[model samples]
Target: MVLHDLRKYSFWGLLSLAINLMYTKIIFPCALLVRRPAHIRILGSYSIGRGFTSGPGLILDVLNDNAELLIGSNVKLNHRCHIGVMKSVKIGNDVLFASNVFISDHTHGSYIGDMQSNPLQPPNEREIVCGNVEIGDKVWIGENVAVLLGVSIGESSIIGANSVVTKDIPAFSIAVGSPARVIKTWDKAVEKWVAVS
Candidate 1:
């Protein structure tokens, strides 16, 4: 009886191992092809399902419980995007995100660092801030854009490269500078967009 149980467990273990290997090499690359030019920022692509749809490489952390959302069908995510997906963050379709884009939903569980001093040392945690971050369809997020928590960017808007977004921005608006102020909006009547002129 013990021999039979061992065999069964070994079979299960091998199956799981095969499955993991398949996703890392085969399934993931195929998904990326579905959306050409798009890349993924992963939270836990191996075990957890936090990753992109059809794109390039992604980075995610399992211990932190951070999730990654796909930008669009075809997007490119450069390296070093610190996405805090402990909460919910959604990106729309046909968007382009530059390198070092911070799409975080939660700033560490506490205000102070969560990393302990030593293996046995206690932790110091403060209030948690978890909110939803949504980027609209066909939006462009520039490099070094620090998107704060609980902010929603409307559809068809252009976010200038290296801008800081603090509050919610309306659709078809051109926001730039620190704290990302809405300089103008897209005017279909004039066939041209207007900023705060």
Candidate 2:
């Protein structure tokens, strides 16, 4: 049993070293350790801090040349997480994202502005509307969560799985549901999470 455990650990350590070398040569310096099959398409300016790691099948796309994407240090994104940016998307330090999470800062067309999209025009050709997204430090985003444009998730907030966040989430709050609403808040007084009234 001991020999088998040692072999398993050795294999993993060697695999991690190989992956790190590949990333150092092919990807940016911020990719400390990343699993295989990551599709990163960058046409914009970006910066990723130290100790950043991503799981397999991660798609990070920055579509526009003027767009900017910033990811802080010690962030981990699980498998199949997609972040598509056309404007600006800033993620703070110590953020953790579960699998299959989608975060985008732009939509295909605008319905509220003067240059509204026409049905006659193809959806792909329609003008894109940009709304920057900001995720504060120490935020934990669950699996299958879609964080849309113009949304700001506050620091240390917890977003439940399968939730669609459309608006701002306050700091130290737990939010859930589609168009996620805050259900619990960290009570600093009691040093615990309490129901939000």
**Model 1 regions more than 4 Å off:** 1-30, 33-58, 61-71, 109-124
Expressed as tens digits, the lDDT of each residue in 61-146 for candidate 2 is 99979989999999999999999999999999999999999999998888875778898888889888889999999999999999
Query: lDDT per residue, candidate 1, 18-47, as tens digits?
Result: 454456456465333222222334543232
For each candidate, what TM-score against the reference? 0.63, 0.89
lDDT of each: 0.62, 0.90
RMSD of each: 12.9, 3.2
Candidate 2 deviant stretches above 4 angstroms:
1-17, 113-116
Position 62, candidate 2: lDDT: 94
TM-score of 1: 0.63
Candidate 1: C-alpha RMSD after superposition? 12.9
Separate clash counts for every candidate = 9, 0
User: Which lDDT value does model 1 have at 12?
Assistant: 67
